[model samples]
Target: MKCIVGLGNPGKRYKDTRHNVGFMAIDELIRRNHWELDKSKFNGNYTVEHIGNEKVILLQPQTFMNLSGESIKPLMNYYNIDVEDVLVIYDDLDLPAGKIRLRQKGGHGGHNGIRSTIDHLGTKEFKRIRIGVGRPVKPIPVVDYVLGNFSEEEQADIAISIKNSADACEMWLKKPFLEVMNEYNS
Candidate 1:
């Protein structure tokens, strides 16, 4: 079994925010897989589906962005899941728009959600699917950049990135992590 977390705030106002890209990708996965995220479990909306013999839980932690680990740790404990079996999909500021990266584990790279996950997990050894939303033209407050909604041009690229992220999550569930990293992380 594995736990897949899509990091984002919960609300209509944040629906189109760059930081909410994680939620958008999960939306794609749900639609593509024809799964319902209606149930409240593991501190968020989730559904268990069979990916081959594996039982995978698709979770969108309602604990919000920075406090996501609070939701994750409890679920992990309840299910007795290893840290490696966890996959976190979130927006990446450093990467360009439509760009994607998949890493097994590392430092947070200034992402509060990622930093929180690492802190609670007690290790930087988990799977992550980093989707790019690109950076603003001029330097701005990190909080504002992440929390703000996307522009028209940004939305176009983000749509593509979200689809690819959903596909990558499916691929990760169906195959080895290296397969996804090699094919999509370039």
Candidate 2:
């Protein structure tokens, strides 16, 4: 089984924020596949289902955004899953809204949640599906902007991106990464 983790903070206050895009994608996947996210003792919620022959664990870390690894590591250790099978879904301030990038490995690129996952996992060699949230035109407080709600103009694009992200997750679960990138990222 593979663990596909959507990193974000919990609660309604963060429900529609840019930082919670990961959560949004998970919501889409569950809605599309009729998967149930039941609470577990691992400081997160998980759902089990099959994507072809592969059993997937859909996860939403409850350790909040910053300390996401705290929830991820325990479940991974318990399942004894390889670091390579972990797929991380997160927001990317580097790309435009509605854009999605699927990469095999790289740096955290200043995302604290991703950084924590890398630290806990001891490698950056896992799959990452980064959905663009875009950057502010003028400089703004990082935390404020990331945790902030989307503007009216950004709403449509964000909605499109969330669905596209779910598609990307499904592609990753089925096809090889390079083929998924060729089909989706291009």
**Which one wins on lDDT?**
2
Q: C-alpha displacement of 149 in model 1, angstroms?
A: 1.3
**What is the per-residue lDDT of model 2 for residues 1-186, given as tens digits with 9 covering 90 to 100?**
788999889999999999999999999999999888975858899887898998888899988999998888899998888888888999999989888888989999999999999899889898988999999877899789989999998999999988988898888788887888787788
Name the weakest run of 10 consecutive residues (lDDT summed) in model 2. 34-43
Identify the leading candidate in terms of TM-score.
Answer: 2
TM-score of each: 0.95, 0.96
Per-residue lDDT tens digits for candidate 1, residues 46-157, read 8888877878888888988998888888888988989989999999999888888899998999998889899888999999989998888878987898899888877778
- Give the Cα error of residue 178 in candidate 1, in Å: 1.0
Q: Could you tell me the TM-score of candidate 1?
A: 0.95
Looking at candidate 1, what is the lDDT of residue 74? 81
Kindly report which residue stretches of model 2 are placed more than 4 angstroms away from their true locations once superposed. none
